[model samples]
Target: MLTPGDGGAGPAVPVGTRGPTVQTLATGEVFAALDASPRGLASADAAARRDRFGPNELPPAGRRGLWQDLVGQFTDLFAVVLLVASAITFLAYGLQKPQDVGTLQLAVAILGVVVLNAAIGFAQEYSAERTAESLQAMVPHTCRVLRDGERRELPARELVPGDVVVLEAGDAVPADCRLVEAHEVSVNNAALTGESDAVGRTGDPVAAGPVLQARNCVFMGTDVVAGAAKAVVFATGAATEFGGIFRLAAAAPRQKTPLQRQVASMARRVAGTALAIGAALFAVRVPAGQSFVETFVFALGVMVALVPEGLPATLSVSLAIGVRRMARRHALVKQLLAVEALGSTTVVCTDKTGTLTQAEMTVVQVWAGGAPHAVSGVGYAPEGDVANPQPVRGLLRAAALCCNARLVPPSDRQGWRVLGDTTEGALLVAAAKAGLDRVTEEAAAPRVAEYPFDSVRKLMSTVHGDTADGYHAYVKGAPQELLARSTSIDWGGERRPLTEELRAAVTAANDELASQGLRVLAAAWRPVSDSRPVQDEVESELTLLGLVGMLDPPRPEVSDAVAACRRARIRIIMVTGDHPLTAEAVARRVGIVSRPAPTVVTGARLDALDDKDLDTLLAAPGELLLCRVSPEHKMRVVTALQRRGEVVAVTGDGANDAPALKHADIGVAMGASGTDVAREAAVIVLLDDSFASIAAAVKLGRSVYQNIRKFLVYVFSSNIG
Candidate 1:
């Protein structure tokens, strides 16, 4: 438990029976509150601290001892060989007298050198863990909360349950709390969930009660990216869900890298072989009347040769080279062992938004009445064309004129422009291609009023045109919402009354697009009287326009990257939270399809497969696509993949992406726009968020592994010789 107080290092008062006592390191004022009383606060801070930090002064104990750890290093074959040699040399030449001093000095020198090497190697390998401690320090230093019925600044750790905390943009939430009030509040839970987008929250109670969705619950260790909120703390300390997760992550043993495992095994083998040879030499020589001391010295020399003292240096250099290569591709590799893990990756689970798509979107399809037009290109670029042809251009003109969105001139990227919103920009561009200038259209049918999109309504309506010309409006959003309002259809490329049959037909078309992995949005329009403005009423008598399909287009270079992985005998599984069609579409575009076209499994389908069944399915010899998988299920998929002896690389930047990233053999986070928590937990950061960079990182990893192998062989042969 933590306590918040003045920044001055003086004293702190512990609250409740379970609260922890704290004292200022400088002033030595102890504070322990049996109850909120003056007498309780009068206690010396020094006494309180002594009762706390002192009692916890001793570090936790665990498996293995310091002496054992030190001894283990000497168990290596080379160390054993050297020890035997030293013993024999000591026995052969007496070092107790001046005459034998020269021989004694030589023996001591060899022993000293071997011991020094062993000490240095052990120290380098056994350094204490500091990463998690450093990360914990990053928690917010201050928190805003109500005290004495007024908002005030307090130390974050002092936050208690039921306390009302104030949050603002960019502020890290100090504790787990239930939102009481919110204003445009959006929290980025990516650290906990692996979701790239910030989830909008409200004061209303969220579902998934008690264990409320982290999306709505302002969790400790998360940050508010935009707007302000007021929340009551429901939990803190180890009781917080994230705290438990952290404990698990911290307690998880640092898994050994493949190279490390191989080296340790080799060390055992060398030790065994040296022991065998030493015994044979000693037994044969002592009976043959040869000096037992001479035979022992030879065995020691053999051990030194077998140790391959330079192998560790070689392995370090190879991994360092790999790290440098990855850095060139904008990938920051943390542990040297990560390079080895990347080389063995058989599955790469990547994020959808920024990883696969540009995250820069554009309106591509527009429909009004029976007219449908296609808008070209994406991003802020103005280099795309509209494919409306002749008659459809008028509808496109209406879409542009009926909205208030605009394109700002680009400061860079010549022949390019940025839009207010991607969907609106699409209309503006479509209007431009139809020979309708956005400037002229805005002037003719100015947006007199507008309603922004909302989750419940699922529609954003813009009202335009003069009262005399009828209140013309354009709406675009989810298909279900649009379908409810639409009463007519545009069939045979013409507007017609929308009956149940027409709605069914349009729904089928939308379904087709969805099946093809297209994110479909429906558009519609209606003319109304200005005097009776009702945005809700606008939905029931609309004409179904057309459907648009958008994709997080695969990078042009991803095809080559996938091919490289395939050639290296690594299986690539495209795991995404996006719709199955969408995930499948991107997979196919990136050459992820099996020769017969891989099977696409939805989250529901994946959940139905038990671990045993999953193993069988994975081993069936073909590619499998898992789509719309939740974070928990994703972790399971990774576990399943690894259980099949496949090394996995899970790449993402969202909060929802965290679990799988943690579970994979290697977690690659996108540095740009990636949450600090994701970066902390990931082994590698793709600074460029490019799939190409991932491929480059993998290639470098393989190279490092190859070098390690070369060093191992060299060490083995030289040691044996």
Candidate 2:
């Protein structure tokens, strides 16, 4: 069994101890095992646990030293052949023709070629390693925990088993733990399990099964999607599921790129043919009365001449040129081989957000006071307008008031940017489009209190009050949730009872907007006479304010880019951590799936299939859309496609995407929004996060490969002459 101390400094617990599987143990039993209480361990106890458990981080796998990499550069087949020929020539010259320096010159020339190639290779590899190290520093490093019965933020690496950690929305879990108290807590376990759907947690114990399936346990590396919980850490570092997978992925050998394999094969064949020809020449000359030493030296000279001494340098230069060209087009190529690999990509597994579509959220449609209106423009620029603004002004106003996101005006080369949630930012932008100035509005009726949004409640309410109107609560959330809380609707500038027929009509409108791949949010307001009423009471009897339809619309250039991929015989498959319907809708809009009914697979459905089933699905002859997939699922999909002899390129922009990014033949990361870990893992970074740039990169990749082959032919032909 894996133990907390297996790879670190933790003290060994008793044999057959179930401390790590604290989910199965009762709350009192867990506290007993840890020698702690509900309040938490004392600072002194925490210090002892830290020494016992070591740092709460996965140990990095041992990497090859610079010396080893430098040595590897001169160890290829061609290099070995040249070394052997130089050695033989040196021996023959020393033994039979010490005074003559021709053979010595030849030997010196061959050694120079070897040393030059090794130096160039070493420099590139060292630079790449440094780049990766820099990128890893971008991930968040701190976590919140309770020590000495006081909640405080601490470096994640300081966490140890038995420590009590507090988890909230947007926080990455610091270590594996058993939930002591949970309130509507939902975790996105995509990094560990390859499932993008958020799983709810509870303090209740679960039956024995997969640890991930347990409702009472949360693992390290997963992010909290909503709610808050207090959990007792049972395992840290390599003992956690995240660390295990990290170790597994690290241990898996990196597959050689197609270009590398081909080059190796060509080098071996050239070396073999040169050796055979030299041997034949030696035999024929020696039998014809020539001295053995002279004949041998002559043969070695011939073999040395056949070796393309500048081939490595030329290949590097060609790839460097391609890299420079790609960089100008907004595609930064990190590795020389990746440039070649991109050309051979038969399938591009791309993420939807920030790659095919602009990552910015925008409000495109609005339904308020029984009227439908369209909001012009895209992104968070806040320069758009609604044709019929008066009817929807009330709804837009409530959405803006209920929002927490702040819109910052353009500054320092950046356009208008959102300071909080993108969804909330879109709402604020929509209100701006309807001529609602946030500054003026907030000044008139400042926010007095707020009932923060929670995943369980599916709504966020803010109490805004002034002397004139007393107090009013503005609420916004999922349309259905708001509809349920509301008792009346504002129609045609008048309030009316929410009848069954009207409710159905509102539901139909929401469905219609959702069907078009828009995210729908409803807004409502209530009159709260009490300045500080209970949150539950404040939410009662809300007046419905209709719905807002928003979407991260596909980039205008993407459709043409998708068409280009088709022309190049490259298949585009979208794999995202989004709803299946949304994924399909975006896929259609971007021209990825031409057929009206394409195969749409969800992560839940993917978990049920075996490797064979996945292979079968991949073998089907059309574009496939994978929704709500985790990093592991993406890696598996890429592996399956590769197993079938397809060259795969994957694009992503999160820390969770690092694994799949490293696993693919060519990984593309978004420069603007991608985490450092992802950028470090990827071979290419798109500065503008554009799909069109990827197509342009593919074109350049193909050209680079062709140019290398052309250079090889020219060098070999010249050597023969």
Candidate 3:
């Protein structure tokens, strides 16, 4: 239970008490719980709720002031030791019978070294913080809400729980809300879930499971891509899921990297050993009647000599150089110490989309006419060879006709650009690659009506006028839905009644494609008496055209990167929000999981396991995959791995991935596709969002450790002289 301060602008709502339960309850029940109505809250009641609930803005991330940052630079243990030694040198010089010029020179030099060290560290820290501030720039906005039966545009900050907000295509959802009424509403949850697909929402209530998967709800930070809906706001500000993630990210404590801990330990040991040796000399000489001023000066000189005067500057310079080299490889290091940590990384927990996979969806296989045909080529390019295109032409043509996406020819600056949905664009590109142009298909069977895909039916249909007098409808959607509506099949260039056996075969085919991690869609068609307003009946008793399976292919360089990680003895484990089959397939494709069937854990199963059980599973030798996991699950896994002395690195590109990114020893974020929340939480941002960059960074980081060792030897040898 989160409240206003989750990250947003107002007073935080009381924990577990203020959030209204909207998803599980009936619409009427929800309205009663919030004391809301279709007409909306009366002006007086709305004012009171606003006052009680605080502002609707998420709390801003706290930033350290320049003064605070500078103060921190001087607080390092090494710097403190040098400062103390410098002060004592001045005291010893003053107490001497005759002022020693050499002692005065030593004190001035130590002060100068301390100042120089502080300056270098402060510059880098300030620069990194300034860059982060650029990423945090935000703007306030407005939303359309109904108040006392009148719809008005108000600041998004003014939105309160129980406000009925009208969502249209292209409008950002103002708050987390339960749908009261929906008309083909579809939302893009990419910001919140990291999945780019448009998910359909309904006004129906669901009794159980995660609210993230609730069909009756729409959440903040999501954009309405199609249709319209009236949803009642239930959560706002930090209380919303969007705000909750950033809150967790900000709240998660980042531990000191191994290198940082080791450096502090070394500094303490060196300072302590030098002081002990100097103290023994003073104790032995004092009994022999040596002057106090003489012994004090001698002890202070020994301490100064033992200290690594140039080490701080050299180390900062070395790490800064590593940052530059990593940038060339497409990784930006936000934390200077992360360079050393990357080299020591033993376990990498990565997300599926944008890291290992190219994230560009392409059609690879088509099942039609009782035979399977493989489509060649990659991305949105319509330049693939379709094996036996003539047999599958009908399926491709009908699928193209039913889609609303358009493809723009390749321009000098960019490749083909998809105007509408990427899934539909894939269908259009598939048709073109098979020599079935969209214009040609449309002219032959011009569409007169369309039924957009919705959460309920899970299918979209378009009624088209064919060469014959009657109208024909082309439909494409979830394979199961289309299969249930289908009564006949296009069997190898011939029409046949779909027998029970044939239906079972079709079901098997769909399952086979899905198990291979392909996004499968079924195509079907039916003849209608007239091209009047399209209705649900128009999709019934259709002819099953077959299925097309698409995949977000793994990047060409990921395999080599995986091999590099293996050679480095870094265990790569995939943790994704995708389905288990999809996660495993991508894991195998990228070489994260080599086993034929790995021990895959779903989020639900993970939730049931205690810490000891989780640790046992993770310690097992076989390939491990976790799918359908939430941010908490990811963070939990990172913690479990760390408990076994593994230095973990987690990669992510969505708001949901923020907490894990913050909690991990190394958080690598995708700069291009990652949400701002994710980027803010990560210490390393990959410009190309490639697993290869991470491998490259680790290589460069390993060199830093060698550089440190070399610097230590040189300093020790120089001090001996």
- Candidate whose lDDT is highest: 3
TM-score-based ranking? 3, 2, 1
lDDT of 1 by residue, 580-659 (tens): 65666767777888465777787888889889988887778777777767767777887787777777888877555666
Tell me which residue pairs clash in candidate 2: 10-52
Worst 10 residues of 2 by lDDT: 8-17
lDDT by residue (153-192, candidate 2, tens digit) is 9999888777788987667888888888887677766445
lDDT of 3 by residue, 1-721 (tens): 2233465454555343233345777788777766689988778877877886766767766867778877887888877887887888888788776888888898898888888777776776667656655654542368999998999999998888878999886578888888989877777776677564578788888766677778889888777766688988887787788888888898899878888888789889888988888898888887889887788777767767877777877778888889889978978788788998998899999888878886667888999866789998877878878998998999999899988767888876456756556688788889988998789778878889998886578899999997766788889999999888888999987889999999989988888888787899999988888888457668898999999998888888999999999999999888888767777888887888786779999999999999999999999988898988888999999999999999999998888899999999999998866777788888888878888999999999999989998999999888656
Which candidate, 2 or 3, would have the higher TM-score against the true structure?
3
Residue 311 in model 3: shift from native, Å? Answer: 1.2
Clashing pairs in 3: 7-58, 7-59, 8-57, 8-58, 8-59, 9-57, 9-58, 369-492
Give per-residue lDDT, candidate 3, residue 412. 68
TM-score of 1: 0.70
